[model samples]
Target: NNFSKSQSNFMDTMLVFSSGTDIRNLRQISAEIESKKGALVENQYRLRKSEVELRRKMRDFNNMKDDAESDPFDVEIMEIEIQEAINSRNGARTYIEAALKTILCMKQQYDAILKNKGIEDVTEIDFENEEEEFHIKKSTQQAFEDIVASGRISVGNNRYLLQIGIMPNLVHDYWIKFLGSPNSYEKKKFDEAREALYQQLKGSAIKEANTRGLDELFYENSCVRIEHRK
Candidate 1:
């Protein structure tokens, strides 16, 4: 019964990824998308079950009218529980919505790439062009990485920032990334440039007791990590 309810809800809210343009990859992409959407619904179902249980306890307590009015402490605790449950349910819904949007964006990008390659009706010439471009891009990225490692180029003074964004509380994965490249700092000017890029951001920015604790600063910023290749 719960599974049926979740399926119904999932189908209603699913961000459609199909465009009917490319028949070759549609089946595979559609299956994967459906699986991803199903997992989200399953997560929501579990969260809502806990919420319903909390609400039931509140209801049962209220049914005992005399006891409910007499005990103020327990009643207050139940009220807090109900509020938290409401928050949890709402958080799950928000998470599902965001995930769907992200999924849709990724699918569009995938379709665009596929169309650019002209793989809808692939030919020998198309395969040759793809192979040539792949090697060129790969070699270019490798060469760029090598140049950055040489330390001959004066990279400038800059601070390395780690930004993290948490959503759906503990249920979803926390997004973490470097705000900018640590290599942007000049190697000659900054003595710590070589090691700072790897070592400086290892510990927590927030001071407590443990200087080793890194997770403490994760929720400080509501930011998503974006990569920019120069």
Candidate 2:
């Protein structure tokens, strides 16, 4: 959205510059966008690494499941592997979903530029429409792992109360929250809740939780700190 807004500003600058308006502001904005472009690229690269790791785990699980008939313990171990693979897969999926937004945002930015160039209308661009897949059995187990891993996943009691999985309640909540919101607000809420989740994902929880509301770092205690008065 910011990119699109900036593109609009670029159009305005075209007229303003011709009428003796300075391009200094436009230059600054362009530089800022360029810096953001670099950061987004870096993030995309990191996400690709995560994607590769997840794909490898998925392959490992498939191979193990294929070989599960060899031993009694093999099925059990393979199931565990499958569950881990699901977790990694979901994590990577979450990252990809977030990154796709950037791509969409960039597309809009480009579209906005075109609009200013006298384009009448724009087509709806689908930057990401493909849904991620998970083994149904594994996903059924994901709720439990989420509860086990995070100690949260709320299940609906209004149903049969068939006792679906361990911490069934939290699992439902996890799925609900995951599907319900794609905005940064939900991401922040998830981060806050994750602070109290299980230990395995503490690193991820903290990393996400640490993202600030603004680019500026707020320090409570520092050599030089700025205090805002109410």
Instruction: Go through the candidates in order and give the clash count of each.
Output: 1, 9
Candidate 2's C-alpha lDDT?
0.43
Report every candidate's CA lDDT. Answer: 0.44, 0.43
Alpha-carbon deviation at 65 in model 1, angstroms:
4.3
User: Model 1: per-residue lDDT, tens digit, 115-218?
Assistant: 88665544334433333223322222233343456522112211112111111111111111111355345544232332233232222234321344553433
lDDT (10s digit) by residue, model 2, range 54-160 = 67766766776677466757656867765765676555555455545544554455455556656543321211111011111233344534554555543433121
Question: Residue pairs in steric clash, candidate 2?
Answer: 152-170, 153-169, 153-170, 153-171, 154-169, 154-170, 154-171, 154-173, 155-169
Give the total clashing residue pairs for model 2.
9
Which stretches in model 1 have alpha-carbon errors above 4 Å?
1-39, 64-70, 121-136, 148-230
RMSD of each: 20.9, 24.8
